[model samples]
Target: MAASSDAACPADPPAIDLRGLTKRFGRTTAVEDLSLTVGRGEVFGFLGPNGAGKSTTIRILLGLVRASAGSATLFGDDVRDVRRAHRHVAYVPADVSLWPSLTGAEILRLLERTGSAVDHEYRGLLVERFALDLDRAAKTYSTGNRQKVALIAAFATRAPLLILDEPTSGLDPLMDREFRRCVIEARDRGQTVFLSSHLLDEVEALCDRVAILRSGRLVEVARIAELRRLRRTEVEVSFTGQPPDLTRTPGVLETQDLGDSRLRFTLSGAAAPALRTLASSEIQTIEVRVPTLEEIFLEYYGGQDR
Candidate 1:
């Protein structure tokens, strides 16, 4: 029997979805009313300072810690449905610990056999590229080497979703770049990567969108460009003549005079009026730079200690 054209196809679900997620331990609340969605093939950045409940949120998604409220779903399956959701997720924790007696190769083999859907060919390349010594025991590896093993295994799994929590904390500069390359490659392969890292520059480089958390609540979720638009720009102008009067100028927040030629000021909102003031003088040089992700992160986490 043939199905009719009117038959409806199932709609694809997002890679990760949360609705009014919350968690509390006894008297303290860890996460509160947080909700977010990470679409398939998206590299999403989760950022927050210490004690911001980032770990609690992740644990809820992993089903390691139960949420006090709301729900978490992966690919349309509730996170509580561990069999289905877990199968699609490969996770790398902030600190990776393995069986001391197992060699790197042995550990990888076990991970594959556990049904993470490892691509053997890709695993071999990762082992070589990450410079992992398969013959060495896990107990003998340095912090960086241990991270390499975890990263290699997780990336090789080829799971539809990769959840990395500060995965590059132990890597050196060179290896850091390598990790970034791997993340880019993962996104290109249409794999979803949920990266929780304190590395603002790394997030800015790799993430299509970022969600910032403060205390137990979500503060902002936006693309990098959109986030930048909400920030103030720093402007510096070197003049050949007396600095033009910027007094009572719209959009100018703070102004500082550097020597007799250079002036620095912070600009918010529109810049056209400020630029006109700078142009009135014989400008020798000018620098207009947007705030970095670190600056934006500070804007959210600064002042109040939690």
Candidate 2:
């Protein structure tokens, strides 16, 4: 008998379904009243700073920790039904650990046999692409190399859902590119990906939507476009003299004097108001651009340590 099956089951229910889920360790609440759903074939981003309950939510989904209240299910099967629920999932954590005595190849084969069905052809290609030395012992691998091993194994599996939490922690720029490519391929293959990362740019590029958590509670769930739309426009105007007094402008949030008769400020909502105000000034040149993802993320975190 085969150790695992690659056969995909019917996906009528969502890939992940959490309803009013909460977890508390005594008086400390790790995740509170969290309700979220990830559809089949959707790439969803899970974002939060440290101590935001992201890890606890993941643990509940994996059946590693039972939720104190509410429910979490995968394809309609309760996560508590570990064996059956696990059949549809593959997960890679930020820090990977393997048997020190086993060779890289052995570990790969072991994970395939124990976790999910193997995609042998894809596995071969990933091994080559990641440039992993399968003959070497796990104990000899560095942090980046260990991450590569786990990523290769996870990407080469036939699981219908993937849960990746900070999976690219120690990878270099070149390997980071490889990881992004694999994520795209996984989406093309109709896999539902739950990506948890501090890399806002990566999330912005790969995920269709994201759920943001803060202080053990769900703050928001929005599409990437919607999040970008919420950002204010950054307008930098160069004048013929001292900057104008647009601080009282309806849409301008803050202003900075860029010297050389230039002013930079953030404008939110409709630009018509700011534009009208700028038209009255002796503007020599004007530059308007949307804020970057990092800037937006900081806004969500209030520029605090995350």
Candidate 3:
């Protein structure tokens, strides 16, 4: 009898799930009480600064390392059951390595053969788009070229889930944009992406939701927009005349004078009062800047040991 696709695995499980996951190495703890879920077909970002345990958590999820405490599942299958769970997932490490004797083309072919299915046509297009010189030997490829090979291989797999750890680290700005486009296309094809990175702009542009890690703990998890809403806005104004006083404004936090009629201030919550105060001045130019992910991360866990 032919095997049934749904016999062992159900369709409704989340793409990724963790509960109180922790890992300790002797006297040090790498990850602590971390928990989050990535929905099917969702682009979820796992973000943290260096030594914050982002890579440790990803290793546990990939079954490359065992968690000292708690549980992690991929598509409702325990990560410990590597053969079963990992068959549905594809991974791209931050630092990619290949056989010295193999050409980029050979490396790609080898990786594709290891997967259950390969989208050869798409893979070819990606190779061209990335400007990868696949004819060259793997030993001859530059950092960016090696990265391109890994990215193309991972993206070409017809796996239901993609686990990318700092996948764009070696790419130039143009390649980075191309990588984002490929991620969106994967999402459109109903594949889930778990992207781990310290690059705030990448997460801001691609992820639907984000989980931020700090000193081995899960600190915050929310939609990107919701997280942004919690941050204070930085506003700067240059006046034709003297700037109006904003110290009395309800939402204003800190104020500074940039000299020559320019004022800079941070506003939390509503901006109505701040706007009213700005209107009272003869404004020459104004600029409002939203908080970046790094700023938000610092706000939560800055000036502390990791």
What are the lDDT figures for the candidates, one per model? 0.91, 0.91, 0.90
Clash pairs, model 3 backbone: none
Q: Residues 37-68, candidate 3, lDDT per residue (tens digit)?
A: 89999999998889999999889988989999
Candidate 1 regions off by >4 Å?
Answer: 1-11, 245-249, 276-281
Per candidate, the number of residue pairs that clash is: 0, 0, 0
Q: TM-scores of all models?
A: 0.91, 0.86, 0.87
Better of 1 and 3 by TM-score: 1
Better of 1 and 2 by TM-score: 1
lDDT of 2 by residue, 168-284 (tens): 999998999999999999999999999999998999889999998999988779997777679888889899855678878888888988788888998877788788888887899
Off by over 4 Å in 3: 1-11, 239-248, 257-261, 276-284
Residue 76 of model 1, lDDT score: 90
Query: For residues 1-306, what per-residue lDDT tens digits would candidate 1 score against the true structure?
Result: 999999999879999999999999999999999999999999999999889999999998888988999999998999987788798889999999988999999988887877578888988998888888999999999999999988999898879999999999889998899899899989999999999999999999999999999888999999998898789899998888678688889989889888868989988888899988877789988999999999988987778755
| Candidate 3 RMSD to the real structure | 4.6
